[model samples]
Target: MKPTQRLISTLAVVATLGVGLTACGPEDDPYGDGAGSGSGGSSASAQPSKKPAPSDKATDRADGPGDCGTPPKLPAGHKMVEPAVPPSKGSLSAKDAKPVCTPNDWIYHGQGKAKYYLFAQDVKAELSTGPGRTKSVPVGQLWVHAGDCMTNPGAVKAPYTCSGNIYDITLDSEGQINSIKEIWHP
Candidate 1:
């Protein structure tokens, strides 16, 4: 490949873009994309993204603000960046939304820690891609329960186990994920 072309490809793979929050603040269509008929311009149920997990440093809760406690700690050699959004007519604000407190700083997957930040109650699962919701996966000593991915409603931990590592997540205005979809891959 030409030097210029290679540079472009490298740059392209690094670029991650997201839709911005609407100024409607829960009063209109999401990002005004006309994807649903919920509201002309409402806060819209959370948002989506292609970016590597949106970030806020994980921290120990103290007398003052430190971190939300859910954003995963940066494993060595991993880069975590904020989500980017294009200019929009308006945007919603998650400034008032209280982040759910998590018991652990990192979500342990099979044998290692997961790189994604999980806000269990705030994200939606998109199953059209052939990935189903998990009842809850055992992470470290805590059970990672997601009500959106539950088969048996109200169950804290389902017998099912999460197997895949590929996923697509959307981020909210505060850099927390709002939606997740499992991507099947080989």
Candidate 2:
């Protein structure tokens, strides 16, 4: 072929290769498992590094509070009793006779302007009365609001049913009291 034609052909091939390579970056892992390993496999399949249990000295020197960040030990004289389950689902009214109130943390509710108090067996007896900060509020008395459904913990956000007593509790924007409806399993 002519010299000029041959030179032009060679330049064309080189230009194509240069453009191809330029389009690829370090992020382009053609054979990688998306982890940049380029091995077409996952590192998660490998056994995790084993960790040693806390030593006695390490446990004692633990810095956090609450029995070394453990559950509180019951008093020696205190007896372990199973948590109680409500007899039924639906609002518990004052006409249902006196409901048991075990002192603990409490959450308050308000409707437009008026406020109300709620008491429960398991829920903390005291909760913040206003937004962001939780002030110590008392559980004066409570009458389960109608239409609330009992639900299991960590389930639906509101209006559900389960074999336990759950409440459709509402709080204001500032964490003020709103309304509460006791939901219990039938």
Candidate 3:
């Protein structure tokens, strides 16, 4: 063959061998255990790269102030009471005949450590204190227990039973929650 043709043939062979060798390296190993190499050492280093298991740091972040404890049990013979006024079919207006508390007031007002309230739909509060009722109550903190009833108009005609501890809360003049006491639960 001509000298130029012979040189071209040799270059092509070398290029093919280079690609074949690269295809067999550690990059091709799916397990990343350096199984492709006879010495079992990673191409990048003597040791294989290791990833921590998900459970390794799970305990580190398991508990926090935002976490809630086991819910309190209701006393024997204690029964959940229905709200004096139930919800109606309209936007939750402060002017509505019934009292309505905003959801997540505890988080926004920085009340108690409980990260979340249970029956969000059942909570309600009056815009102003009613006669014979303390201003702090219904306007401050209202407790709701499991089995307590609420009306979610247009959804269910009958009163809806709460499944967990819920609280109706009001913010203080400073936009802070007044309390987080558990008045009732089941």
Candidate 4:
């Protein structure tokens, strides 16, 4: 072969070898275990990337406040003070009628933690998305303050203060929702 052709053949062989070696390099391992080098002292699967789980931190809030203890429930006369509304329809002010609570394309108001209330022009049990009276809210029972014009329900914590709104809801002795009043707050 000519000198130039011989040189070209040698260069081609070197290039092919380099590419083969690179293809078998550390990053190419499909299993990602880095097992081929035999330095596999620690398997990738064995060690997690993030820190270990916290013993003190709570992942959920169902337990209660202060990261401990049984959480507070609705106070005594809670139901009697306010009435329960179907969660799907949301709450309303005293001046507002129950039918006003349901609208065909209603807006959502924030309810207790992780919950939302839908206010519409009318709510029909036949037309609602959930059971006759229940929704998959953060908590059971929809509560509305009697006086507050704001439609949102308060958070689930104790002493659920009203923000110029009277939740029309009242609680029973068992802390379950009992009634919703048609009367407005004075």
Q: Please, what are the lDDT tens digits per residue for candidate 4 over residues 1-186?
A: 699999999999999999888877433544434334321111000111222123322321222221111112333553212222333334432221111111111111233323223343322221112112222222223332222223543443323333222233443444333443222211
Model 3 stretches with alpha carbons more than 4 Å out: 30-34, 38-186
RMSD to truth, every model: 20.8, 19.3, 20.4, 20.1
Runs of candidate 2 exceeding 4 Å displacement: 26-186
lDDT of each: 0.30, 0.28, 0.29, 0.30
Compose the digit string of candidate 3's lDDT tens values, residues 82-154: 2333323321111101111121111111122222222333334422122112223342223322112343323
The TM-score measured for candidate 2 stands at: 0.17
Q: Per-prediction TM-score, please?
A: 0.22, 0.17, 0.19, 0.20
For model 4, what is the C-alpha lDDT against the true structure? 0.30
Residue 128 of candidate 4: its Cα lDDT? 13
In terms of lDDT, the poorest run of 10 residues in model 3 is 99-108
Q: Which lDDT tens digits does candidate 2 get at residues 21-97?
A: 88453224343212321211111011112211233323422422111111122223321111122222322222111
Which residue pairs collide in model 3, if any?
99-125, 100-125, 101-125
| Model 4 collision count | 31
